[model samples]
Target: MCRSGTAMRLTALTLLALLLTACGAGGGQDAQKGGRKPVFPVQVLEVQGGTVEYAISSTGSVEAFEQVLVTARVRGVIEKVNFREGQEVNPGDILVEIEPQRYRNELEAAQARLDKADASLKDAQAGLKRREDANRQTPGIFSPDEVESWRNRVNSAKADVSQATADVKIAQLNLRDAFATAPMAGIIQSRSVQSGAYVQPGALIATLLRRDPLLLRFTVDEDEARSLKQGQQATFTVTDVDQPLKAVLTHIAASASSRSRMVEVIAEVAPEDRERVRPGTFARIRIVTGSRDNAPAIPQTAVRPTERGFVAFVVENGQARMRLLTLGLRTEDGRVEVREGVKPGEKLVVRGAEALKDGVAVKIDEPVQPQDK
Candidate 1:
């Protein structure tokens, strides 16, 4: 009975095995028909070599090209202020007027003294001529000592006249100085003294700023500063301004700042853009440090930063391949220069790279052309 039971169990197991084999064969056939790996859709660009301009960004303030402090040249009561605050003035434009009565009176007094001295000089010359005539006509009639005395008197009168004439010139100059004039063309920044106020010589009257060509002052780190050169182009934008100001680097400090260890740089704003900006306005400046020509470049979206280095995806043989790159300059636009590990004319996956893995199959749309550098 035990032998018969064992034989039945083996027959049941054999039938179950046959049913499993048939199901496995059917599953294998289905997989063979419909098991193709997915092809990821992606956007790509043909990598091209072009010029890349590297920039260093820094913040700075706009300053006037030149600043002048207008001062009072003579002491008097301020009679009239000819200019309002922030008025545009030209060279020789009268800005302030001091009370001219005092200066006028002084000039008149000097003129009168000069006239008196002139008359005295004439009298002295006439006297000396008369004495000489008398001595020549009558020999020994006038003593030598007496002739010498006449000559000395004439010389004294001439000296007095000369002194009075110099005083008159000084008085004339003082009167002219009573009216303060602009020494240069600029915009008045402030008005320190008002009409009817007393002012002394050398007292601050107003501040003037030359705004036709503004100056932009900024600082760079030690490495960037060392590489800076005069005549490099820079562009800056200020708050609330739609347009940017173009400038050229004109000056670089010989030594770095003691406190910050950064070097100072100066740039002159383009003449056409100066009036649009004002001094002390904060600006963000991008200075062109260097440029690369015909360098392999890719769009910024294609590159991803990782712990080891930067990684990019390139399409090769209808599959995505990962590339490690040594990067150089990033241009003003969105292109990044690849220093190593990439070549021109290669297909770069600019978009749809987030989901891509190395060696994955990809279905690319129409390849994009690279933009002008």
Candidate 2:
């Protein structure tokens, strides 16, 4: 009886030992599975505030402020063209000269007539003086009717002299008109009439463009137009030009076009840069609507679209924290303005943001480098 009791006790102790070991193994497995750590490879950036300019880009053409179509003012055969094709000219520079022989002959005839009229006026004055003296010497002997006739003849001779003087002035003006001169300083873009081509009054001879202080015209959409104002500064780039040209906003249309729903804007280029640009060239305009000082911004690549809103991953205490951000304007490059949800001097995960989640542990294998301008 004593041996059997001992055996039963030993068996119970062995079973209890086995049960304790199984419980310990189950606890170990739970710990290994539940306490697993998340590992993330990320790139980080320091966020800071600075001046940020928001710009709108549009394509437009370069234009001239003053474009003139040169035309003949008088009808005649073109004798000589003083200006060559694509020549630059100043105001009052003679561009073309018509045949002046006809006008010269008319002027000579007018001068001869004027000379004859002057001689006739001298004779008429002498006659009037003689008639007045006769009237004074013999008031009753000289008939009043005869004196009146002499007065009328003197008046008629004076009228003839006045008419001839007017003719002479008209002839001189015609001779001056034979030479066509430029009305403004500009470059000759095209020439339509040759040296020997017969041209009438108002015939197109050439086209001139005022290139100095050139004008640039562009249209902006309704949303963009709302941000623009007069007297703003803008920069533009043209094809084949290495650097951008600067200009000032001169005008903003008060009303938008009904059909296109766009507003027209005009910018004036500086005179010094006019030689490098030409009219009708395509250009790209960047207009700055507003600017922010000391604002937090991040590379556009760092931002990712999420279900809630735009989000960016930030590395804090070696863990990834997803932040909801409010965005502002985008810069010319790939950077975007962060209005809220991020502070300056905080590191942002730029490269590995896509593969990250909230509370994930991150290991920054490489540092992020800024892009070149």
- lDDT of each model, Cα atoms only? 0.89, 0.87
Per candidate, the number of residue pairs that clash is: 0, 0
Instruction: List the candidates' TM-scores in order.
Output: 0.75, 0.79
Model 2 residue 219 distance off true place after TM-score fit, in angstroms = 3.7
Q: Residue-wise lDDT of candidate 1 within 210-276, one digit each (tens)?
A: 8867899999988898778999889999997898789999999999999999999999999888878
Predicted structure 2, TM vs. truth: 0.79
Clashing pairs in 1: none
